[model samples]
Target: MVSLTPVDIEGFTFLAISVELPKTTLLVVTSERGYIMCGALDVGLLNERLKDRKILAGRAVGVKTIDELLEAPLESVTHEALDAGITPGMLGKDALLLML
Candidate 1:
């Protein structure tokens, strides 16, 4: 199953997406500039192999739902995200605010 919803955070609108698969679910919240995703995201690849693309994103581990993903602290973030002031240990919601 796949779900996509518009999420409001401090008056800003972001897109929340969830994809359910066997034994796992993929979760993500995205704004116009960046996004935060569940453990399925490969921060390393985004930071290194795709550095030229300058993707702004973060990853949170152990989040089973979009709400959890929003509340969870980021475990890793892309280099562009770092440049944009998003960092590991920052809450997913907080990181998103920076992306705006």
Candidate 2:
């Protein structure tokens, strides 16, 4: 099951997702403004993948989903970033702004 709730952390607003599974709990956090930060388990892996892609794209930050992002071989995840028009620097700034 999945549950969504609004939460305030350090003054910033976020939407939290609680996923109940057999073994572990999964939490996904998205900024109320639409930025996704860190999360649990596979979510962290997804964040790392996106972060790596952002760096390769020459920008600071970006927003993406595993299903929506482009898959590139031989090149970094930059293809998705380029398609999304996000810069690595912008990713960083936005992440900071969202307090992620």
Candidate 3:
């Protein structure tokens, strides 16, 4: 199953996605400029192999739902995200705010 939802934060709209497969689920919340995702995201690859893309993204581990992903602190973030003031240990929603 796949679910896409619109999340509102401080009057800003962000898109939340949930994909269920086998025993795991993928979760993500995205703003216009960037996104935050569950452990399935590869922050290292984004920072290293895909650095030129300047992808603004963050990853949070151990989150089972989009809401948890939004509330949890990021385990890692892309370099572009760092340059944009998003950082590891920043809450997902906070990172998203900066992304916007």
Highest-lDDT candidate: 1
The runs of at least 3 residues in candidate 2 whose Cα sits more than 4 Å from the true structure, single-residue gaps closed, are 32-100
Query: What's the TM-score of every candidate structure?
Result: 0.98, 0.37, 0.98
Q: Comparing 2 and 3 by lDDT, which wins?
A: 3
Q: Candidate 1 vs. truth: CA RMSD?
A: 0.6
- Which residue segments of model 3 deviate by more than 4 Å? none
The 10-residue segment with the lowest total lDDT in model 1: 43-52
What residue pairs clash in candidate 2, if any at all?
A: 59-87, 59-88, 59-89, 60-87, 60-88, 60-89, 60-91, 60-92, 61-88, 61-91
lDDT of 1 by residue, 1-100 (tens): 9999999999999999999999999999999999999999999998789999999999999999999999999999999999999989999999999999
Order of candidates by lDDT, top first?
1, 3, 2
The Cα error of candidate 1 at residue 94, in Å, is: 0.7
**How much is 74 displaced in model 1, in angstroms?**
0.3
lDDT, each prediction: 0.95, 0.38, 0.94
lDDT of 3 by residue, 1-100 (tens): 9999999988999999999999999999998899999999999999899999999999999999888998999999999999999989999999999998
